[model samples]
Target chain A: MILTAAFFSAAIVAGTPLLFATLGEIITEKAGNLNLGVEGMMLMGAVMGFMVGLKTNSPFLAILAAAVAGGAGAFIYAFLTVTLRANQVVSGLTLTIFGTGFSGFIGKGLVGEIMTVDIRKFFAPVEVPLLSKIPIVGQVFFHQDMFVYLGYILAVLLGIYMYKTSKGLNLTAVGENPAAADVASISVSMYKYLHILLGGALCGLGGAYLSLVYVPAWQENITAGRGWIAVALVIFATWNPYKALFGSYLFGGLDIIGFRIQGSGLAVNQYFINMLPYLVTIIVLVTISFRKSKKNSPPAGLSVPYFREER
Target chain B: MKKQLSFLLVAALILSLVLAGCGGNKPAETPAEKDMVVGFIYVGPIGDGGYTFAHNEGRLHLEQELGVKTLYKENVAEEDQEVMNAVADMIDQGATVVFATSFGHMDGLEKASKEYPEVAFMHCSGFKMTENMGNYFGRMYQARYLSGIVAGLKTETNNIGYVGAFEIPEVVRGLNAFTLGVKSVNPEAVVNFKTTQTWYDPATEKEAAKALLDAGADVIAQHQDTAGPQQAAEEAGAFSIGYNTDMKAAAPGAYMTAPIWNWGPYYVTQVQAVIDGTWKAESYWGGMADEIVALAPLTELAPAEAAELIEAAKAKFISGETDVFVGPINDNEGNLKIAEGQKLTDEEMLSMDWYVEGVKK
Candidate 1:
């Protein structure tokens, strides 16, 4: 029973970052801006957050720095694709490459340096008064670190903001048909810019979670292609914030289930076990391809740059 | 105007690519200006805080002690072509001696050795050797055994966990030696072993450790590089044994001791030999006596008797009184793998594939 709880708890811990990054991309795509630079932005965030955490020794300041760094990276992408009329795919891919190299260059000195201040305590699990008394659910859900709680709150709030609000409806229209939205008196560029920055900030938070809560230390390329996993997760969630949450946790669970199988004294090839998550991803992707529900489809204006004069 | 702007951007991108290519082809120093240069090619980034970090530390030590110009290319992929390129790059930079610190680099280094007969090449943790190339590895299993003793005594629960990187011989040998150490001290203790199949991935490694702890393992030991498992042990308030380097800082409360490689002394000796024209191609597996491998200082988390026990075992290793693979050993299936009053030869130990009796999966 304890092992089962540990499994779910570990899944949540692993999935929190994916949830944040997926939600960020979903928001950006809703504004008709397909930002493929999620990996790059997260790397920027991871390195910057670790640097600030080392300097100020404050978790809050570190997270803030991470968001700012990620936003800065997005700003470059936004300018190139949205304003300069460059290819969105090319621009986003360049951002990934640039952010990766930039983070490694900047984080060179932080390698192997022990944290002067222990921020693990600051981000440690805070047990809720009455809720944590519950059997398995409370221990798995309420006993998570500050970031996991924040991820839950953010996912719920974003779900409401994306579906229930009038602005969100307009954002959806902008994604489906920017010219129609422009004719309907919505500022397309303004929405794209705001959500792109917001998306980048969330991706940055995802990166911060790894450097702060996961490893709680600095390592180069620490995100380890998780940013790309987040990109896959955005599609797996079918553009719904709640679904994204489920998908992230599910992905996280599949990632570590192999160890649990081995821990049970079962003799299984570790390679095959390690391949479980990606294999499931491929199967899910294939299954999703057969379902052509319009609601489940990607944003219409995704990867398409808007031109007002052409309209 | 738009067309001109796009054209200019394209030109800039092409220019940058050309410039990058030019940088790669930069000329080496003239013969008279050339000095003794040592090059290191690593499989991972120096900041990985595991294997590469230890090697980088040794590189730094070599610089300080020998006063030689050193060059290193970190994050060099283990692919044969990439290793060859890295070696050629170092040679182009006038490196007289190159050390490829990864097992996967053996094939590439062997091929490079024939290509560059004048230069000396050293590969770590592989058997392949050429006239100008040699392989070197420390007997890390010795320290693994000592740390296992510490974990065995420290654990209140008889379940001890080991986070391994792969199913390779290096990791398997370490795990077996560790289980033997644990059994020697506490016969009832069982060592649970699981592989992450990755050298360093903090998130997954930590999860593997957590799974072990959740399964009632009160102590953790790892053959992986990252401190993820150690940090997990610390969070669970369980004892841990670290590898590659002294990782006490990663998990102050959980850390007991670690098996570490002191490559500076060995690197210096090899480089000095090359300078004196005494370099040779031979398989060198140094043990505690050579100081190439040693156990990290035990923290207060260890049992009081851990110190004396570890000291006695270490002395035996140093004095050649006993080795880790001495027989009366049985595989986990209860099959006699090594007969009584016999010992495993170096060739046998290098290719160890089976688990000891106390190891569980």
Candidate 2:
């Protein structure tokens, strides 16, 4: 029973970062901008957050540094794809390369340095008073670190903002048909820049989570392609922040289930177990494609640059 | 006009990428004209805190001790073409000696050695050689065995979790020796083993460690890179045995000891040999006596008796007494793989693929 509880608890831990990154991508896509620089932005966030955490020994400053660094990366993407009319895909890929190299170069001195700050406890789990009285769900969900709680709050708030607000409807209109939204005076560029920066900030939070809360260490390429997984997760969640929450946990659960079962005297091949998360992602994508739910498809303007003159 | 502007931007981007790909970091101003330039190719970033970090430490030692100028290319994929490209790049930079520190670089180094006969090439943990190339690795299993004794004595739960990188002979050999060490001290203890199949993915490795903790293992031992497992054990309030380097700082509370490679002394010797014109193509597997492999100092987390126990076992390794893989052994399947009063020859140890008893995979 303890093992089962631990598994679910860990699932949330693993999923929190994914939830952040996926929601970031969803918000960006909804702004008619498909910023594939999630990986790069996260690295900037991870390194900056870790560096700040180490130097100032303050988690608050570190968190702020991570968000700003990630937003800075998105700012570059927005300038290239939005202002200069550069190809979104090419610019995003370049950002990934740049972020990878930049982090490595800056983080060279930090490689093996023992973190002096007790950042782990700063992000450690805090049990909710009333929720702690419940059963398995309480232990798994409510009794989590600050970062996990942040993920839950962010997901629900984003869900409400996207579906229940008039401003969100304008953002959706800008994504589905930017020309129509432009005709309605919605200011398409403003929405894209605003949300893309917001998206970048969230992705940075995800990266900070990996360095500060997950491994709590600075290593080169520390994200290890998790940013890419979060991108796929955006599609899996069909741009719904709430669904993205569950999707992130589902993927995170599968990621470590092999390890949990391997200790139980199971004969499962570990290599196959390691591939479980990616495999499930592919299967979900295939099943979703077959279902042909148009509502579940991507934002109409995703990856499409809007030019007023062309429209 | 806008079309022309965007076209120019795209062209500039592509050109910059191409330039970045070709540009290698130029080494510090060539040491006095007589200084020998050494080159290193690593399979992972030097920041890995494990395998590549140890190798980088060796390179630094080579620079400081011998005053030889050094250049390195890190995170080179273990592909023959990529290894060759890195080798070619180093050779282009006037490197007289090259070290390829990954098993997969063996073939590439073989071909490069033949192509550059005047240059000395050394491959780590591989079995390929040419006139200009040789192989070198430490008997890390010796240190592994000693640390295993520490884990065995320290664990209160009797459930020791081992995170393995791959099931190859090198890893398997270490796993067996460690389990044997555990069984020697505590026959009732079980070593729960799981492979992440990756050398240095922190998140994945940490999860694997957490899984072991959930399964009731109180002591975590890892044959993988990164301090991820150590961090996991520390978080769980469990003891940990590290590998490759001392990881006490990574997990101050959880860290017990680690089997570390002291490649600096050996690197100094090999590079000095090259300078003396006595370099030869031979496989060198140095043991504890050579100081190439040694155990990290046991921490307060280790049992008080662990220090004496480890020293007694380490003495045998230094004195050339009992080896870790002495016979009278059985594979996990209960098949007698070796007879009593016998020991595994170097050839047998090199090709070991089976697990010893009490190692649950």
TM-score of B-chain for each predicted structure, in order: 0.94, 0.95
TM-score of each: 0.95, 0.95
Tens-digit lDDT track of model 2 for B1-361: 8789879978998998798767656544444568788999998888888999899899999999998989998888878788888888887777889999998888878888888899999899998878889999999999999988988887788999999988889999999989988887889899999888788889899999999988889999999999999999998999999999899889999999999989999889989999999988889999999999999988888999888888899898899988998889999999999999789998899999999999998
Tens-digit per-residue lDDT, A14-116, candidate 1: 8988888998999988888888999999989998998999898888899999999888888888888787867988999999999898888789898775444
Task: Give the range where candidate 1 chain B is weakest over 10 consecutive residues by summed lDDT.
Answer: B25-34
Q: Identify the runs in model 1 with alpha carbons over 4 angstroms from their true place.
A: A1-3, A115-118, A265-289, B1-34
Model 2: runs farther than 4 Å from truth? A1-3, A283-291, B1-24, B31-33
- Extract clashing residue pairs from model 1: none
Residue A170 displacement in candidate 1 (angstroms):
1.0
Candidate no. 2 TM-score:
0.95
Best-performing candidate as measured by TM-score: 2
Model 1: fnat (fraction of native contacts): 0.78
